[model samples]
Target chain A: MAQATLDIPANKIWGGGTSPFGASYGKLMMWFFLLSDAFSFSSLLVALGYARHVHADTWPLVENVFFHFPLTHAHLPLLYVGLMTFILIISSVTMVLAVDAGHTNNKKGVIFWLGLTVVGGLVFLGSQAWEWYTFIVGGEGVVKSIIVDGEVQKVLVQGANLQNNEYGHTLFANFFFFITGFHGFHVFSGVVINAIVLYQATQGVFERRGHYEMVEKAGLYWHFVDLVWVFVFTFFYLL
Target chain B: MNHVEDQSLHYSRPHSRTPEESKAVRKKILVVTGLLSLITVVEILIGVYFSKTHVGEGTWTLIKWFYIILTLVKAGYIVLVFMHLGDENKSLRTTVLLPMVLVIYLIFIALFEGEVLIQYVQEFMK
Candidate 1:
């Protein structure tokens, strides 16, 4: 430890007053904040796994539950969700492009890429809304056992709600809503943030500051949102 | 310290890359994009097809683990390449990634307790 400390130059020493991470304060804070956010998302997914495990016998097969496609009569399992995944991935690419353009101080490039990214985000959010609608409305009604007049009787149930689900188990719908709702909210906020950043870029905020760090920061967030969705898609739909 | 007046530091200048470097960056971005897309396609195909057609429970379990591993690969690329965490200093990278290790613990405990609880419910509550 003494030799290592002595090998460092005076200016390089992190004596409680320097950016030891070689990053701007804002960027470092953004990373830490994202780390914390990752924990929150992890816990939520963990809870979903726990609940699914406890009710493993009754848990619905996810592919069967999410097979519907827009403007189609045929049953297509995992098609719509797959499309949504592609949409988010494409947006993440555009976001990284925007950050790359920012690195080169290319304002027009940043605007173009950022604009595309915003559109991609909106499209993904719209797709998610459609998915949620299909989920809440469900498909064909199924007969389920329910207590009626102090006796258990088979009754036809439709769709999904907090109380019950036409799907295999109620927890299935609950977890779907909670996990995807949380992720959807993140995408919504990411879009809003990207739009604001786009406006700021147009108004020459980052250009005047002589750096596009804000875009890079927002790009980090957008990528994090996409990252979370990757897990959600696997655990919720694919698994 | 006159840090504000010193233009020699060039602290406010935007990063400039050579033409070759720019080309490399663009190529890397495109490659990562293609890789991510391909992995997603493979995942979808496996989920949609193999989940229905896979022969046995062992094979199905293998496919599930494959799905998880592929998802992690995709995630690593996003964080490391797209998010540029790969370019950050080692200290910063460690600071960000170390805490995520706890998530493995969380997953293990939750699933274990779930199995135990379900068994308990079967034995007692039922």
Candidate 2:
């Protein structure tokens, strides 16, 4: 009986010597990594929600706080972040095209689409840097009463920091810096990874390997970055 | 040169497609992108214009719910299509989505606890 069982082919979906989920090891692991990352971001956003609810009365209106745009004196009211969202979404499309081209073994298509994706990521990082700059510099300072040296004094506070902000509550800037800054770091890392993969593609690395799986893996990471940004954009800016 | 072509090692889809198939894939990408863009535009319009106009009203809360739902729709598309989870085996899909339930549970717990804490604080201050 033991010999018979050993001789039988384990051809079931969960059988040995085959992937259970029809995905390669690397891709499945990437998905799990993204899931864990999702947990991290969800925790942050949920905390933000809780804090926003707790401070409902004094919470600053996000639009009123983020009104400025790059090189524009006019108040744009979500236009700049909206542009960022489009850039991210477009880059995500390009990433999917890259993966599709990889599936077809089209080296040129992979390089082109991946190149555009890298450019999109760089542009987004630059845009985020500008936004951080605007936020740190802030607008005309807000005057608030503070106790300095045991006496109440009217002090003008400008910009945002860990301690205080011209915005209504300190937690507002705290969450803003933490969440967006974390997302920006992810974007920066994605760009770096994409640039490296693009360089490898130019060197015909995947072509010689007989498959462009690396590009697809990189594309997975890239699209995940875009996916996280979708939630971040909604929670941080829109809602 | 050696080529790796094992179904177990490679992805689920074949490594090449016909021109028509590739075109269809590209078309799907374009369609999804357009849908995502449209939803974002609608969200911004509501967030910017209607939010300002509806301040402190039931409609504002309703609009927020609308935005959240639309955001979820966009997120689903990105994960399902762009990341190609929709193309994966059913087992893979379940594996990925099942854990997300915990996240939803956490959100509700946090929101509910926050409400209770704020109520207790208000009563204490009074």
Deviation in Å, model 2, residue B98 alpha carbon: 0.8
Position A119, candidate 1: lDDT: 100
Supply the TM-score for candidate 2. 0.93
Output the TM-score of candidate 1: 0.93
Alpha-carbon lDDT, every model: 0.89, 0.86
**What tens-digit string does per-residue lDDT give for candidate 2 at B62-88?**
877888899889989988998888988
lDDT tens digits, residue span A1-239, model 1: 46444676543567745566777777878899999999999999999989988988889888778999999878888889999999999999999999889888899999999999999999999999999999889878899998889999998888888868898888888888899999999999999999999999999988878888889889999999999999999988888
Poorest lDDT segment (10 consecutive residues) of candidate 2 chain B: B5-14
Best by DockQ: 2
| Model 2 misplaced regions, further than 4 Å | A1-11, A147-152, B1-9, B12-14
Least lDDT summed over 10 consecutive residues: which range in candidate 2 chain A?
A: A4-13
lDDT of 2 by residue, A94-205 (tens): 8998888888878899899999999999999999999999999898989988778999898999998886789888999999999999899999999999999999999998
Off by over 4 Å in 1: A1-5, A9-12, A147-154, B1-13, B52-54
What's the lDDT for residue B17 in model 2?
Answer: 70
